[model samples]
Target chain A: MAKISMIVNGNPVNANVDPRTLLVQFLRENLRLTGTHVGCDTSQCGACVVHLDGRAVKSCTTLAVMADGHEVKTIEGLAADGAPLHPMQEAFREHHGLQCGFCTPGMIMTAVDLVHRKGHELSDEVIREELEGNLCRCTGYQNIVASIAAGAKAMAKSDLA
Target chain B: MYEFKYHRPGTVRQAANLLVKNEDAKLIAGGHTLVPVMKQRLASPPHLVDLSHIEGLDTIEMKGRSLVIGATAKHAEVANSAVVGEAIPALAELAGLIGDPAVRHRGTIGGSLANNDPTADYPAAVLALGATIVTNKRRLKAEEYFQGLFSTALEADEIITKVMFPVPKKAAYVKFRNQASRYALVGVFVAKRPSDVRVAVTGAGSDGVFRVTAFEDALKKRFSHKVLDGIAVSADGLNSDLHGSAEYRAHLIGVLTRRAVEAANAKD
Candidate 1:
């Protein structure tokens, strides 16, 4: 077992984990932070997206040992459970971004990072291009694109972008 | 995934020592490609050496006439680097177009070159730029470094410390990327140097990333699209799969090479 220390969801976490435990597995199974889903255990699906030291990364492909001493933020920690919805999440609800809700967490996480990198006032074309990694089998991505644009704008106003 | 021992070596010497000591060991940078393969049970090295703990292996700076990028420099860093942009904007663009934003944040140039995935974007750039790969032991020119698909001249204990790319007069990379994964379909990188012009193509070769001497010779005569007007690359030995046929890739090799040369000459 490898002993690892990291900050997850803005809280300090230390644990003895198997060498093979993935970051997503540690988040979902160890800490019970199931908010970061594992849609595709392979790296193709971004459902296990999370923030490592303020940058977005695919947790499914990141080993827990590799994330040692790093800061990881999941969807659950985006705004806490009940305080208030983050602007990105709010935009998703406002624009009806999700259909089956399976890919929402990854979408929102990826969208926030996109806004952070590409600026909040993103074009529909840019959003469509930026979302090349994350896939939504439902809704044909029309509402998702609109939600991301609105979310990026909201994030800009919130000074979070 | 198979269980293994993880070692985060703080220095290249220590990492090399660990690799030499461990019978079954693999050096991992960023773990974007390595971890996925491990999960698939395709590769399961008993000892995984994580290179992130090393200090100086992630630096990107201009050293004299060459842009020296350390082994662990992430794609995002390269993409956003002013040094890379100024030295070779096409190289920076290639780095940015690798995978997606998150993957770019985690994937490293060293890992990509070390893996030598034929579909990867950096091989074309490295080959076309005539970059010298600096390893812990020795230096290798791009021509000698890349042997074939998923192959490099690196020995088991050797670690890539830095890659030194001589700043060309002008260069650009044009990729016909896979629609979903965005791996290059027939990416062409054209570089014009004081000595000679180099044209490297990735994702279209049976062996791996290779140069187009015909295009290079034509571009050397006159670096323009019309110079390559009738240069027809033979379809033999090119890659053929569900995404593209050998003839299609050959045809694309012509078109993208022209575009790359135009893009290269247009900037300067």
Candidate 2:
């Protein structure tokens, strides 16, 4: 086993893990940070999306060792200490961005990263294109797209984005 | 993924030494392609020398007349770089269209080229642009580097450091992408440089990325989409799959090449 250290959800995390342990496995099995779901074990499903050094990456395809010495942000880290929901989360809640909720965590995570990269103003076409990685099994992309649009506008309003 | 000892080498020489010592060691850059194969049990290298710890290996800069991109440069870095956009817009655009944003954030050009996946987008650009692949050992032209599908001329211990792309007068890439994976169903890259015209095809080649000398010769006479009106590569050795027939891919080569030439001639 290799000892790995990284900052996950703004907390320094240290763990002894197998070399084959994926970042998703480390988060879900090791730390019990199950919010980053693994919908499809394959990289096709964006269910394991998380921010590695502030950029969205599919943790399912990432090695735990590869993430060493990096800062990772996940769904649990979004709203801190009984705080209100993040703008994207609120937008999803308000706009009904999910149905079965299996893909929600990854969707919200991907949406947050989208806002970070493309900024607070995003066109529907751009959102649809950028969201090619994330899949909603319920086929609820219309609502998810709507939530992201509203979420971006809300993020633009507040500094909490 | 199989268990392996991980090494984070600080320098290229150190990484090379690790490869030589371990013998079964594999270099992991961005791990997008290698890790996936390992998970599927397609490969199981006993040791992985992580390339992330090396400093200044991901820089993108203009050297003399070429844009020299460091080996570890992520697809997203190449896609979003101002120099890449200004120097070769089509190359930047090609980088942007690779995989998804998440994959782009993690996928490196060096890994992609080293793997030489036939469906990848970079090889066409590399071949058409006549780029030079700089390795720890020596630099080779794109033609000599790519051997075949899932193959490259890189020796076991050699490490790719950078790719120097000569700026073309005009260039563009057109791919009929598979909707699910966004890999090219049939992609064509057309480049008009000061010296010569080059047309490279990927995704449709059974032998991997290849140049179209017929199309190149036609463009030499007249560098216009109209000149390629009647051109069609034979379907003899092309890829035939459920997604498309070999004939269909061959036909796409003609249509896409024409469109790529038109796109190249279109204004910045």
Give fnat of each prediction, in order: 0.82, 0.77
Q: Once model 1 is optimally superposed onto the true structure by TM-score, how far is the C-alpha of residue B234 displaced, in angstroms?
A: 1.0
Backbone clashes in each candidate structure, one number apiece?
0, 0
Error of 1 at B158 (Å): 0.3
Query: What is the C-alpha lDDT profile of model 2 across A117-141, one tens digit per residue?
Result: 9998899999999998999989559
List where candidate 1 sits over 4 angstroms from the true fold: A159-161
How much does each candidate deviate from the true structure in C-alpha RMSD?
A: 1.0, 0.9
Expressed as tens digits, the lDDT of each residue in B100-171 for candidate 1 is: 888998999999999999888999999999999999999999999999999999999999999999999989
- Write one digit per residue (lDDT tens) for candidate 2, span B1-268: 7788988899999999999999789999899999889999899999999998799999999989999999999999999999999999999999999999999999999999999999999999999999999999999999999999999999999999999999999999998999777799999999999989999999999999999999999998888989987777899889999999999999999999999999998945
- Model 2 regions more than 4 Å off: none
* DockQ of each candidate, alpha-carbon based: 0.86, 0.84
TM-score of 2: 0.99
**Scored by CA lDDT, what does every candidate get?**
0.92, 0.93
**Lowest-sum lDDT 10-residue window in model 2 chain A:** A152-161
What root-mean-square deviation over C-alphas does model 1 reach? 1.0
